[model samples]
Target: MTDHVDVLIVGAGLSGIGAAYRLQTMSKGKTYAILESRAAAGGTWDLFRYPGIRSDSDMYTLSFPFKPWTHANAIADGEDIRRYIHDTAHENKIDQHIRFGHRVTRASWSSDDAQWTVDASTDDGPVTITASFLYLCSGYYNYDQGYTPEFPGLEDFEGEVVHPQFWTDDVDYEGKEVVVIGSGATAVTLIPSMAGSTKHVTMLQRSPTYITALPQGDPIAGFLRKILPGGIAHRLTRIKNAAIAIGFYVFSQRFPQQASKFLIGRARKSLPADFDPKHLTPTYNPWDQRLCIVPNGDLFRTLRSGKASIVTDRIARFTKTGIDLESGEHLDADLVVTATGLQVVAFGQIAVEVDGRKIDSHETYVYKGMMFSGIPNFAWCVGYTNASWTLRADLTSQYVCRLINHMDARGYAFGMPDPAGASGDAAPLLNLQSGYVQRVAGILPQQGSSSPWTIRQNWFLDAWDNRRADLDEAMVWTRQREVARAG
Candidate 1:
């Protein structure tokens, strides 16, 4: 049992850390604690240890606003990111308040007290802590499970089965055939990284996703980093990246067919003449699912080097040697890596309960994608999947600070959206077509079925609302002790 705190932020990933940084900087004398399930911080970065792992988004936009990114590599690697997070926390003195290895299992809200009762499992066992506000900085990515499709006769297979999420350093693919499944970012990253170590590598994807290539390091940023201050360079790069992201987001949303055609055209050029673009191309819409980024055409380079190749087919079953695709093709391998996809769980499978009743996440709409409808005294950070995640996270953090001030100024104990306002004609949030989004559909806060909550996935809206302006009407504020009445 622990005494109450002003704020309790779960997870230590980009979003979680961002919330802490903002809260500390914005709130005066506010007590906050960051509970990380892992032994150390660096949420996703710390958890994933696959080779060639790095940010898909540019560092300029990914880095925190207060802590400027000066790394020459426009897209930074995992270790570099972990270091940056650590440095940011330490420099800001946020490290002192974090509880490592404290995995939060359930958070229950007390309508009477207008506070949250958080039950967490630490190394010592379960302990309950109370807080006025619970900020779910836990990113949409699931922590407990990695994507591992049931390969038929997986037990019969003698080869090692692996997942990108739980990749370890010791898995030796030296001179062995490796098959990496799934075409998303994880598989794209795996093929290039394991090509050299393995005898030959095959990137097996059921269908193609939009894959655009960028260099490992930005030449322009590299030059500017040497001449200009790190902060200045960070600002320049962030803005430039944001502009590009904005253009794409708008283009895709406004002109779906046109944008898809343009993407197809680019794919044709980047890929080989023999490569089929139809199955490789998506059908629904662009920006509906996240795009994959490969550094310096890493997958292309691997293909060019004759060390790797891409196979598009449905994985029908698993045999002792490898996977059997529904197309009657079998991929023989000594090792198999399922980069299939992620499972987006609501609140990371960490339940949210109000009074004795468990909160129905699906019934709620997202207000600014940070706070939920009918969920009180709680704020969570969900970033742009279309762009750099940090861009949205940073904005969310700033928004929270404003919310705290709003609560303080007016004297409201708790704030959850008036369920009355959520009823009638409002639709379930999100327009994503990915399986992960579907798994947790209705549970996630509605962004309006459009963007910025119901629909805004662009980075510009995030920056404008978070760093550039005052808190908007979408947010609900609460006082220190008042609780929202849940129906």
Candidate 2:
């Protein structure tokens, strides 16, 4: 049977669930349904099972506003995060609204009907649904495809080859020399977690990534939560974290050397005096890509325990014995993990159209970094790099709700970003070399060259412009739609 609803949320991940929670509470007399591709919720948490998979950022900003993240460490583990997502959904009564295993394959917009026709593949087979608003929360991380490098002579390797995104529990790596390629967050996480279980883990990366250590627990936050109400505590905690990030960011802009010194200097002091900076210190500026956070120095602890080793070398090829390095050294391994990274897709690879014209997202610019330049009745939530992802995601959700509520109040069926009649001199979305961002550079959302939506990775600024702003005069609203009706 087919279904119809006021809103159809795609993916039951944090962004999707966050949208549902806000809609349930704020949207009066609105019927909504959440469609999840997997049988379970907690999108990333439920899926990724690589060793040491967990949140690099703190839980305070990660958790919803209505929920209290009581984890002792600011950073939490995979299970802890999975449980948190499940708990948030349950406590908020959003679990019933979620129809799991509904993998959305195609979504086509019908302007005549002012709705979206979503085609999904579920266990029950193909089914179609329609909704007034379609919100995509499926993150940039591709669920079906993880990055796997094509190594020459890989077939000759006598070891099990795996990608972290597609890990299975059956594989045994005990006493095996494990080589985890790439030095992204995933690789860093896996190194420490597998050190004890495996013979040794060699993190093979061509270049270095900045790694920083954060306290497991927040000292002032611990004190406030005990005395203050949970909501108040969360607000204070979020504010404190935002301020600290801003200070570092401002310094990074004003005095690059001082900022680098403060950051790398700490790293230098923490590790052994003889530890090579060539391996530990990266060449790029801070926040160039994303910094991997090691909780309470757990990674360092694992290193001190004598089970893990970091190797800086490019892979030459795979052999019957193991991976051959460019330096002519062979690291024999029982298994190889290509913890390379993810392939990001804007709007979860769902097709969008306007006025019978299929939208080539690669062709449009990001308006406000949430809505596309010409898309209507939709807002996609991608994750963050510097601040907690949920921080920006929550803001986007709140703003969307307010925008929808305003539209509904005025009897409007849609709101679209009309960048059609522009100044004609706008640049592409991103000019960086982020593995995923670079792929969708021209097609991704374009923010203003300098401010608000230009993709600034600041939490306080995001919270203010989105969360605290007045719903009036947002530039993209249904007032134009209502006025056009009179004409």
Candidate 3:
């Protein structure tokens, strides 16, 4: 006897939970099971325990469309986000379908059987299950460990060293000199949150990144919630915030020089007069990499108050007490935090095979920003890099449900994207030039140069396009009897 489901989701995070809800509502009577690698849900929100862990995007867009975010703050903390995910799961009874500690290692699709044979390792033993369709919502990063560069003479440092991904309660920084490496979101967040308690906090970056400030709470949302219904207010706010984000991204891309001036000018106003303008300047234009957001100008406030500071220089090596910079400056620190970046991986590093042939993701093209070329009955849930992740994630989930329903209506057993059906040169799946993305560009999948195949970062355009997308475009469908007869 073998356990089976109509659909199998690989994660229990925001995307997975949302996908489950969509499947249940849009594709009714579809039996599904969620496999979570960790003991708990909330994926990224649960894994990252560092101080000041909060969403870079507004909660209105970050949250699921089915569930309204009732919190007053638009920029929510990690714990709140985790609680929201759990509540969504419990409310929809989706939690009942999740199998914790079940890490999926491989999925093999058989055209003859018209199903996927999935294998997973668990605390109890190896578990095997079969599904008609597979939805991968496991996220893009390496969860086993975060990326930490090999610093010269790291062992020589006498101070406590830590990575934001692995922050623990026992690693105290109270009244201690802290040096945080990398000027990304984690570094900006850690500096402001830890500066007040620590004796001094310093952000050490190899180069500057574009940083900006946003209000923690949305005044318009607060006003709307007071007047309109919860659902209506949430939808309006989500749309408004999403549009603003898309507009800004477009503005930055269309007018780089003006956007750069605007960003730097805003930062200068927030900082002290004597602060060096050079430290705030970045070599690249705006939107070249993701922008760092500090809620309520907290990072700038910390800098102005003399509680925290920023140092831009290349690291020569780690000394006995602290770091020796290439600029002949030695910064003393009692603790060092490597806020380098995340290690990007495709499909949670799961080994996927079709007809006993392993999938080479690098050789495949992304179909409609979700499905892969030549892959049958599969979809990967990836979010936007420019806007809130859920904005795109919700659309992806809905689109999957639509696809499933379409297949059932036509009595199709499986559908695969055919690369020959689309005409365009191949491009990187992700358009960003960030270090983490560039590091794994060669390993990730490619996108076609035209619509349906291109992964657009604009949420507004995606929402409009997804609703009117042609389900039959560039897709090859087959019936179960046909597969069996061919075999």
Candidate 4:
């Protein structure tokens, strides 16, 4: 089967839906359809069903700017986030344009016609879709499987071992001793949530991660919502949240000692006086790997109440009942949850070919963090590592729409970044030291040493550049051969 459209969007997740909305409003009369590999709309929200699954970033900034997030909790649950995404799609009538169960496998660009021929696998069979522009909002993580480190004697363990990425409703941990192996955001979330039902929850970690507590609902946002119009309130709240988040990130990078002290002091106050502070304090500086947020100090309160505890140690191997530590200690666990980390996959693992030539992602350079160097009519949405991801997602979508509009007005069929030099000496694309990021850093594209090619982590800069910057500055625009010949 074959279908044709002006724009072909991959993924019907938060970014994809938002991209569709931008095209609908900004680039009117443009025919576009969203291809979702999953049967549902929400991407990460739908995939993760772990206990106490919630947003690491506030919803005001995480949600689409056009849609008002009227929910009371700033830190919303996964279900709520999923519902919000679905509601946005339904409200904008974007859901009707989405073809679910379409897993895009390959995309090939033709300079002769200035079009993309996308191949996808579906339950029915293989289908081909062509479009003038290809927008990848599929995100950078693998949906089918998460990062699972090879552990010795993992198969010898008798009890159930689960990863938060594939959590199921039927996996029972009621009144049982559960040991969650990880110190990341997922571990912090699961410890407190599972502690309510489990007899005891032990958070076993290789190293401690920075844990910070914020209120579930923002009091200022709540006040604004009551006094101002829904849209006004949402905008104000988003700005406030974004400013605070950016300020903190900047402060952490500038003054690591002060930020680390402040973060450790906050964690210490949340826990009991007798509790050892080493487990809550990370060796690395703040914002080094993401700071884990637990609303209302729930994790600390759980620890203080003796329902849960944290153990920072190396895992030697898995035993019959639990994991054995390198320090000659063993944890008794009935159920083990590996909240380890995720496996990052760029562009949904889809193969890209330009005129019968396969594109190696590592060989290319990232253009303004959205589009790739020398790759025409293609852009991917990658969010900030330090702040809310949706903030960047929103900006990138708008820029894409603007680019499309610009090409249409200028009679240009192809647009791609033509970097001055190869990015062989450029910095890592992500600039993150997280396990998942480090594991795949070599495979992903590199960010240039200068502007227009280097990806900025600052939301304010990104917002400005996306909205006002001239695309022609770095991008090379061209007319299709047939069109040029006819002209």
Candidate 5:
């Protein structure tokens, strides 16, 4: 016997749970199931157990729109976020629909059947399931491994080396000298988090990234929650935070020089007087890559206290005791942490086939930043790179529900975006020049130069356009009989 459903959603993380909620509420009669690769929920929150694994984005916008984030802190810890996702699942009964330990390997679409046959690997064995539509909420990164660049003589290092993605309780750093490689969000986060217990901590970087400080808690959100209802307060806070994020991004893009100065100035004010300004400055303009955030200037405070330090230089090689810099500086360390970056993957790296033909994602153009061109009854959930992930994720879920409902009402068995409809030169799906994104640009999908096919990072525009989107625009709808007759 084969398991079947009206919808099969991949992942049980933030996006999957929200997708399930929207599907149940909006598309009432649809039967759905969530297939999670991991044994637990919370996806990224559950997978990454690093020391200072709190959200860089504020929780007000990062959290689901339907669920009010009652926590006082705007920047929430990883465990809190994991718990919140679990609580949401439990409250909505979404947990009952989740099949844990089932990692989807392949999805095959048949135009004749107007359904998808999905193959998944599980502890028990291989499992096959069929669904009318497939929604991939698996995120955009490889969960099994994080990206770490090959460093010369890495094997020669005598100290214990660890990657933030694979952090374990047994790997101790307390009272020991530690050096963290890369100056991304993970590095900044780990430096402050580990500085308290470590003898000394150093952040080693090839180049500097834009780093800034933000308050750990939102005072306005706390006030709103106290004075108004939970739902209203959540909505208002989400709007406020989202607006601020969008405004900042716009300002950064339009006035890169001023933005760079403002960010560097803030960092300069936070750091010690003798600290080299060159170490904090980057060659690229602001918004070229993502800016790292530290809650309440904790990282700066740690740096000022002499517990932690930053070194901006290329690696000469890894020594037995520490890494040798290109500038002939040597630092001793007991433990080395590679807080490098994540390996970006598309469609969870699951092989997708349509009517016995393998569909290459790179060749396909993105439709509304969610669906691929020439792909029927399928959607991928990816969040905004500039703002809290949940903001864009929520909009995507709602749009998926709307698309499903539209198909059902029109008696259409399947709907695919027409490749011909998308005009103009194609561009990379993601707009950021971040290392992680640039590394896998060849594998990711493409976006058109105009709306419906363009991926604009604006939340307000996406929300409004999604609400009023035309179901027929650049879409090819067909019924089962039509497919059969054509065949």
Candidate 6:
């Protein structure tokens, strides 16, 4: 019997249902909930259900500029983005303040009663909670494992061994044969959705990622949603697909050899002609580690209709029926999918303290990338490693509802991030080199050496520095210091 809130939220998916619709439409009378350790509510589109689980950014900037992704496929899938996050948490009732299987696991913070207790993890077990701000939107990876790399004869394979994040449904790749190792974006979206029900889908990969095709419906956002209106045709198709994904990530980082020869001459005019389009290109450069999207060319028409395939090389093991190519080549497979990625578990692994110490999120720093420094009222979002992670999660939920309405109009209670003693010379809080962000870049957090603790993966410089800054430079606020009223 210990539950309270003014804002708790920790992951109801898609940035915890858009941070509970911006803390119930801008902090009015507070009182939040949203625990969700998955009983459902599409976090990673309901923890990816394998075979073509889509959206590698392109649901018009990955949705949530206050909804309006009236789908017409701008590369959707994953059950229509988990039924548009269960219809945006049941049309804003926010699905009765969520709670699904709880699971927070720890969060102390005190400052002599400035609140925040938390503990979660439930099936009718450990509960305790208390809050006054702590929203994390649990995302930066590890939704119960999905990065497996052991293969030295992986227990002599002999078929069936998948891991598209534990995909089930009595796992059946129909005619089977599959292979799919990883080149990123879930092995080019499971080699064209498991090459039309398997019997042939290879992929393998050791290097080479940049592939592109796009156009899974969006003729100018379906002709401005049939003559404008639906929120101005979703804000002019989210500002023309966020200015064409920020002009193709600043023209492939300022023209990397003419953007890798215009993405290997558009994958050699969409493959076939003896295949070879240099194994669909990539050796870094082109968002350096993410650029797969295959909407219309559908993985070069499943590798020019030979069903599907693409080797690249480097495996040397796991062979009871499949894989062995350290240049001897084997590849037989009945099923082996280890779309090799993801495991950067930043926050869902909870545990944070403060009064009792234990904070060390890589010796804390990150601020505008959504609060951290010395952590106080707390906040967490982390989106955009080039573009469209809900376009910096809708500007970090509108700058965390303008820093909780400017700490309740200045009466304050806690706020943090006073990096006055700064010393993290920026560049680490995910500048993506991906292999699950360089295997947990020394336990995350640390981006400074400039503006509001630096981390601008540009959404127009985080909308002119986190939606027009100036909430008392680098914040600090306090005020729970009055206790002599017992006279």
Model 5 misplacement above 4 A: 484-487
| Tens digits of per-residue lDDT for model 6, 249-334 | 88888988898898889778877677776577777788867677778978888788898888898998887888888899898888
Q: How well does each candidate superpose onto the true structure, as a TM-score?
A: 0.92, 0.93, 0.98, 0.98, 0.98, 0.35
Positional deviation of 77 in candidate 3, in angstroms? Answer: 0.7
lDDT of 6: 0.81
> Candidate 3 overall Cα lDDT vs. reference?
0.93
Whole-model Cα lDDT per candidate?
0.78, 0.78, 0.93, 0.90, 0.93, 0.81
Which candidate model has the greater TM-score, 3 or 4? 3
Give the worst 10-residue stretch by lDDT in candidate 2. Answer: 471-480
Every model: Cα RMSD to truth: 2.9, 2.6, 1.1, 1.4, 1.1, 19.7
lDDT string, candidate 3, 102-210, tens digits: 9999999998899999999998889999999999999999998888999999999999999999999998999999999999899999999999899999999989999
CA lDDT, candidate 3, residue 356:
97
Candidate 1 residue lDDT tens string, 371-397: 776788787777777888888788778
lDDT of 2 at 280: 77
Stretches of candidate 6 above 4 Å error? 1-55, 63-139, 142-146, 154-179, 182-185, 189-214, 220-222, 225-294, 307-338, 348-351, 357-376, 382-392, 406-410, 415-487
lDDT of 6 at 362: 77
- Local error of candidate 6 at 192, Å? 7.0
As for candidate 5, its clashing pairs are none
Instruction: Specify the poorest-scoring 10-residue window by lDDT in model 6.
Output: 478-487
| Candidate 1 whole-model C-alpha lDDT, 0 to 1 | 0.78
Task: Quote model 5's TM-score.
Answer: 0.98
